[model samples]
Target chain A: MSLTRLAIKSLLLRPARTLLTIVSVAASVAVLFSLLSFNSGYQEGLQKQMQQMGVHLMVVPIGCPYEAASLVLEGGEIENYLNESVAEEIAGMEGVAIAAPSLMHAIVRPEDGRTDIYLGVDEKHLELKNWWRLNDGEKPGPGLLSEDDAVLLGWDAALIEKREAIGERIWVPEIESEFSVTGILEPTGTQDDGFFYVPLRTAQEQFGLEGKITAVQVRLTDPSMAAEVADALDARFAGVEIIRMEELLGSMTALMDSARALIFAIVAVVIAISGVGVLNTMLMSVFERTREIGVLRATGAGRLHIFSLVWTETLALTVIGGVTGLGLAAVAARGVEAVIKRFVPMAPQEAMTRFDPHAALICVLAILGVGLVAGIYPSLRAAQIRTIEALRSE
Target chain B: MAIRNLWRSYERGSETVHALAEFDLTVQPGEMVGIVGRSGSGKTTLLNQIGCLDRPTTGQVIIAGTDVTALPERELVAFRRDHIGFIFQLFYLLPTLSVAENVGMPMLFARAHDRERVRAICERVGLADQMTALPGSLDGGDMQRVAIARALVNDPALLLADEPTGRLERQARDEVLDIFDDLRADGLAIVMATHDLEQAARCGRVIELRDGRRLEHAYEDSWPKAHCAT
Candidate 1:
C-alpha cells in the first residue's frame, strides 16, 4: 500500500475525529468560496446594471446623490423633486441627445404586503430606454402610452396585476385612477421588470406633483463631452445636482470593496482557526500512534516517510473539505445572496452569487496552502519521534 | 552479524542506569540465537541495538561488515531498511492497515513493493486468508504472524525479534517457532529475545543476561554453561 492510501486509512481509523476536523475545514472553505463568488458576481452585476441604465448622467434635486440615484434606478418615492422644465432645458443643450424626465411614486400597501412603484415618462424616456421590448409583438416607443389613461406594465408588474394582454384595465386604489394596459414590457432581468409605466402628466396630476419630476436621465450624443455637459448643467440648474454615471459606479464599487475587505478579514480569521483545528487533530492522531510509528521505523520507514505519511493525511482532510465546501456553496448561493443584500447597500437587482470557476480554483489553492502550513508541525513531530522511545510509549 | 563492547545507558534524574554494558555477540548466517533475560535485564535494549532502532552509548554494531554505529543517521536508516528486520513482542501492527498492507509496509518504505512477493510472504506466514483483514479484527497469534510477515517482506539479512511469541498461546507459539526454524533453514539469521526458558531452548544457541551483563552462554547440545562476565 502507498503512503497516501495508508494516510487515508489512518484518518478513517478515528472516523468521528476525522469527520469533525473535515467539517470545520469545510465550514471555513464554504464561507471563503461564497465570499469569492460574491466578489466576482457583485462586481459583474454592478457593471451590468450600470450598462443597462443607458444614461450618461442623472439630474436630481439637491440631496444625497447616491440615495437619489438608488431611488431612481430602483423604483421608490423620492423626498425631493426637480422641475419638469429641466428636461426640456437639458434636451436643448448642444451635447445632450435626450433628457428623459421621470416621476417615480411608490404606493406601499401594508395590508397587501407589497409596494407598487409607478414610473411616469414620455417619448424621450422611451428613447433613452431603447432596450425595452414589449410582449404581444408591439413596439415600445413614443405612442405606446399615447392615451391619457394608458399604462405600460413591466413583466413582473403585469404578472402581479394579472394583466398580461393589451387593453387590460387596472384600477389603482391608492391613486383612485383606472388605466388601460396598452403594452407589457418583457423581462429585462432588472428593476425595470417590476415597475408600472404611465404618462408623465397623468402621473404628476394624479399624484398631486404636477410640473415636477424626480429625475432626468440624460444621454449625451458625444460620450466624451460628459464632463463639459455636467459642468454646464451645474451652472445652469440651481436646484438640481448632476451625478455622472461613471462616478456613481465608482462610488458603489468602492463601497462594495470596503465591505468585501471586512468580510475577507473575517474569512481569513475563520480559515486560520480551521487550520488550527487541522493541526490539533493531526497532532492528536500522531500522539496516539507513537507505537505504530515506531513499528514503521522498525520496519525500515525513514523520518521522511513518517513525515510524508502524516502530511499526506492532512492534505487529504483539506482536499475532501474543500470539495465538499464548494458543493455546499453552490447549493446555498441563493440564500447567501439574500443575506448579502440585507446588509449591503445598493445591491444590484441582478444576482450577486454566480459561480466563478476562477474563484473556485483560488479557494482550492488556498485550502492547499492551509493544509501545507498546518501539516508541518505535526508531520515534524511524528518524524522526530525516537524509535526506541516511541516503541516504549504506552 | 557482530556486536563489540555494546553499552546502552539511560539518565534517570541524577543516576545513570546501564541497560546493556560491555556486551559482545557474534551470530553466523543460518543460525537462530535467543537472548534470555528477566525484566530490566536489557534484553529489549540489545535487540534494539541489533535492529538499529537504538544506538549504543559507545560501541560498534557491525552487521554484514558495516559498523552501523559509525554510519550517518540517513545511511544508517537505509542500511537497516535494506539489511535488518524486526518483530516486536506486542505485535505493533498499524490498526488502519489490512494484513496485506501491514505485510507490505517494509517494502513500501524500501520503494521496492511487489504485490506478488507480498502475497507469497503472507501465504508463507499462513496469513493468505487474512490478507484483507485489519489488525484489530485479528487474534493475537494472527496479528503476530502479520508482524512477522511484515519483517520478512524486505528480505533482510538479519532478523531481530524481541519476544516474538511472548504474547501468543502455546499452539501459536509452536507454529511461530516452526516458522523460525524454516527461515533459519533458508539461511536467514535470526536473533530473538525471550523470557521463556522452554522457548529459548529451541534456539541453536542461547545467551542469558542479568543486570546488563552476560550470565551464561548455553548451547542446545551442552544444555547450559555458566559464563559470567561484567
Candidate 2:
C-alpha cells in the first residue's frame, strides 16, 4: 500500500471527525466566496452606474446635493428646484459643452397607493444621456414639448402598471391628467427602467412650476477642464452646489474599498478559525495512531515519510471542503439575488452576488495555504514521535 | 553483528536511569540468539537500540561491519530500512490494512518490493490463505504470521523481535517457533527477547539481563541450549 492510501484509510477510520473537519473548512471557504462575489459584483455595478450617468457635472440647490444625487440616481423623492434660467447661464459658461436641464418628482398613485418616479427632460437631454434606448416609437420631439399630452414609459413602469404603453393612455392622479405614451424605454437594469419620462414644458405646466428645474446636467468640452469649470460655476452660481461626477465616483470607490477591507478581515478570521479546527483534528489523529506510527518507524519508515502521511490527509480534507464550499456558495448567491430582487427595489439590478473564475482561483489557493500551515505542527509532532515511547502508548 | 559498550539513559525528574548499561554482544549468521530477562530488565531497550529506533547515550553498534552509531539520522534510516526487520509482542499489525497490505507496508517505505514478491513472502510465512483479510479479523497466530511476513518482506540482514510470541497461545507459540527455526535454517540471524524458558531453550545462545546488565547462564533452570554455528 502507498503512504497516501494509508493516510486516506487512517482518516476513514474515524468518519465523524474527518467529516467535521471538512465542514469547518467548508464554512470558511463559503464565507470567503460570498464576500468576494459581493465585492466584485458591487464594484462592477457601480462602474456601470457611473458610466450611465454620462454628465460630467451636476448643479443642485445649495445644502441638498446628496438629496439631488439620490433624486437622479435612485429616483428618490425631492422638493428642491432651481430656476430654469440657470441652464442658459451654465450653457454660456467657459468649457461647457451641453447643459441639459431636468426636473424630478415623486407621486403615489391614488388608485394603487404605489410610489413612482416622474422625470422631465428637454429635447436635448436624451442626446446627453447616451445609455437610454427606445424599445418602440421615437422619442417625444419639440412638437410634443408644447402639447403636454404625450409621455414615454420605462420598461419596469409598464410592467408595474401591466400596460402595453406604446399607444396606451395612463392617468397621473397627482397631476389629475391623462397622457398617451409616445414610446417605451428598453430596460437598462438601472434606476432608469423604473421612471416615467415627459417633456420638460409639459411637466413644468402640469406641476405648475413653469419656470423651475430640479437639476442642470453639464458636459465639459474637454473632461480635463472639469475642475476649473466646476470651480467657476461654484463661484458664480450662489445658493447652488456644483458636483463633479468624477469626485462623486472617487468617494464612492473609497467607500467600497473600506467595505472590501472589512469583508476580507472577516474572511481571514473565519479561515484562521477553520485552520485551527484542522490542527485540532490532525493532532487528535496523531495521538490515536501513535502505535501505528511506532510500528511504521520500526518497519523502517523515516520521519519525513510519517510527516508526509499526516500532511497529505489534512490537504485532502481541506481541498475537498473548499470545492464543496464553492458550489454551495454559488447556489446560495443565486438564492440571495432572487430574494433581494423581490424585496429591495432600490438595489441596483446588476449588483447581485456573483463568483468569477478569478475569485474561485484565489479561494482555492487560500484554502490550500491554510491546509499547509495548519498541518505543520501536527505533522511535525507525528514525525518527531519516539518509536519506543509511541509503542509503549496504549 | 556486534554491540560494544552500549548505554541508554533517560532523565527521571532529578535523577538519571540507565535502561541498558555497558552491554556487549556479538552474533553470527544462521544463529538464533535469545535474550531472557525479568520485567524492566532492559531487553526491550536493547532491541530498540539495535533496531535504530532510539539513539544510545554512549556506545557503538556495528551491524555488518558498519558503525551505525556514527551514521547520521538520514543514513541511519536508509541503513535500518536495508538491514533490520522488527516484530513486537503485540503483533503490531496495522488494523486498517489487509494481511497482504500490512506485510507489504515496509516495502512501501523501502521502495523495493513487487506484488509477486509480496505474495511469495506471504506464502512463505504460511498466510497465503489469509492475505486478503484485515489484521483485526485474524486470529493471534495469523496476525503474528503477518508480522513475520512484513519483517521478511525487505529481506533484512538482522531480525529483531521483542517478545515475539508473548501474546500467543501454546499452539500459536509453537507455530511461531517453528517459523523461527525455518528462518535460522535459511541462514538468517534472529534476536528474540522472551521470558518463556521453553522458548529460550530453542535458541543457540541465551543471555539473561538483570538491572541493566547481562549475565550468561543467570537462570538456574535446567534448559537445553542448541549449539551455535562457528
Candidate 3:
C-alpha cells in the first residue's frame, strides 16, 4: 500500500523491461567496480614489491634500464652483462650500504616444458634479500654464499627437483656440474621462490663467464641521497646505467594512471548509457500508466506522490543493479586480472584486483547518483500530467 | 455541496467548445444524485469539477463551506484527499495492487493508513473474501467494488462517480447500486454520472444534459419537484 511497494509492483508489471534496464546498469557498474579494485590492488602490490626489494638502485649494462631491471628481478636471461668490478666500485661509494651483484641465467629445457633459472650471488646479495628464510630443521648459518659447490634451492625449485633435504645434490645438465644443496629457502611469495642460488665464483667458473654479472643491486645508507649517489654512479661508470627504484615506481604508476584514465572514460560512457536506459524505461512506464496516474490523482494523490512513485522505481532499479554488479566484480576478479596483465606493463605476480569495501561504497553512491539524475525528467512528466487529460488518455 | 455558474471550455483549432456551460446544482447530505446524458454530454466534465480533478473556467464549488475553486493546487489536493472521493466508470483499479491495497490507496496518499478501516470498507463493499486478490484477477463487479472501497476509505463528505457501472453487467451493476444505497443512507452525499436511464431513475434526483447545457424540458417532465438550481 506504500508508494515504494506500488512502484516496485509497477516495475514488476513489465518484467522484461525492468530486468533489461537493471542488467545494463549492472554492466556499467561492474566495469567501474573492477577498475577501482584494480587501481587499488595494483598500487598496493607494486609498493609491497618495491619495499620487499630492499634495494635503492640498480646498475645495469647500458640499455633500457627498466627492461633490464625487470628481467633481473623476474629471473630472465640477459643479452649483456656488467663487470663484477662494478659491485666493488659501487660498494666503495660514500652512501652505498650494500652492493649485491648477481648473474642471472635461464636454462630452457624445451623437452621438459619448463625453464630453470639460476642466480649467482655473493654474501652481500643475501643481505639485500633479507626476507629469505631457510627451511625448517635446517641450521641457519652464514648461508651457502661462501661454501664451494653449495647451492640454495628456492621452495618451488626444491619441490620440483625433489631436493627437500640438506646435502641433496642436483646435477645441472646445461652446466655439466653437480652441486650439493646447503639449504632450502622457504616460500617468499616472489620470483625468488622459483630460483636456484649458487656461489658467485662457482657459477662464473662453471658457466664460463668469469668476472661478469648481470646487474648490481645497491642499498643506500640514506635513501634520501638516492639522486646524488645515482649521479655519482652515472658519472663514474662508463658502460652502466643507474636505475633508481623510486623513479621506476613513479614511472610505472604514471603509466598505470594513464591507462586508468582511459578505462575511467569508458566506464563513464557506459554509466551514461545506463542512465539513459533507465530514463527511457521509466518514461515508457509513465506513458503506459497515464490513466492509472489519473486515477491516483482522482483518489487524492498529489503531484509529489506521483513523482516519488516514479523516482522510487528508478532508485530500486539502480540499487539492485549496483549490488548485483558488485557481486559480479568479486566473482570475476581473477579473470579480469589475467586479461589486464596482457595489456598492462610490469604487472605484479600477485593478484591485481582486490575487493575493497570503500570502493564498493563509492560505486553504490555513484549508481544512486545516476538514479537521482535519471529519474528527474520522468518523475516530473508523471507529476505534471493534467488529471483530466490523463484520465482521457487511451 | 453546491456548484454555481460552472463553465468548462476548450479551444479546438480556432473555435471554442464549451464542455459545460453555466451549470449549477445543489445536493443535500444523505442524497444520491445521478447525472445522465448521451456521448459528449459533459457528465465526466461535471464530475471532474466537483471532484477537484479539473478546474471550471468560471464557477464556484463550495463543499463543507469552503470554496474549493479558490484553493491553491496544493491545498485543493489536500481538500480532495480529506473531503472528496471518486469512482471511475472503468473501475481504474491499479492492476498490480491487491484488492486490499487498492482500497488502501487513498489512505496511502493521505499518509494515514488504517488497516481496520480498510478491512471494514472491504467488508462493507462485499469484498471481504477478495481482499488479497489482484485487480487483474477480479471480475468487473469485484473490480468496481474495490474502487468503491478505495473511494470510501477516506470517509469523505461527498463522493463523485463518473459512469460507475457503465462497464458492468446487470447483476454487477445492481450490486454496486446496492452499495451506493447503503452509503447514501449513512448520510454521505453522492453524485454519479451514468448512461443507464434505468439506473439514474433510482436516484433521489436525476439531471440530464445536452451540448454542455441542462435539458430543462427533460428535467421538468421527468421529475416535477427537482431540487437542482439550473
Per-candidate TM equals 0.81, 0.79, 0.82
Q: Which ranges of candidate 1 are over 4 A from the true structure?
A: A58-124, A130-181, A184-216, A220-243, B216-221, B224-230
lDDT digits (tens) for residues A20-40 of candidate 3: 888888888888898888878
The candidates' DockQ values read: 0.71, 0.64, 0.71
**RMSD, one per candidate, in order:** 6.3, 6.0, 5.9
Write down the DockQ of candidate 3: 0.71
Error of 1 at B106 (Å): 0.9
Mark the 10 consecutive residues where model 2 chain A has the least summed lDDT. A338-347
* Cα lDDT of model 3 by residue, B152-204, tens digit: 99999999988889899999999999999999999999999988777877688
> Could you arrange the candidates by lDDT from highest to lowest?
1, 3, 2
lDDT of 2 by residue, A1-394 (tens): 7877888878888989989888888878977887777777767777777666778898988766765655545435456678999999999998998899988777655467566777888876876766676775454344434447877778998888777746688887667899887777778776778878888888888877788898899988887788999999988988888878888778777877876787788888988898999999999999999998988888888999999999999898899899988988887887756553463223466646977888898899999999999999999999999888999999
**Fnat per predicted structure, each in turn:** 0.92, 0.78, 0.86
Model 1, position A306, has a per-residue lDDT of 98
**What is the C-alpha lDDT profile of model 1 across A216-307, one tens digit per residue?**
99998876688999999999989788888778767887987887787788778988998999999999999999988888888888999999
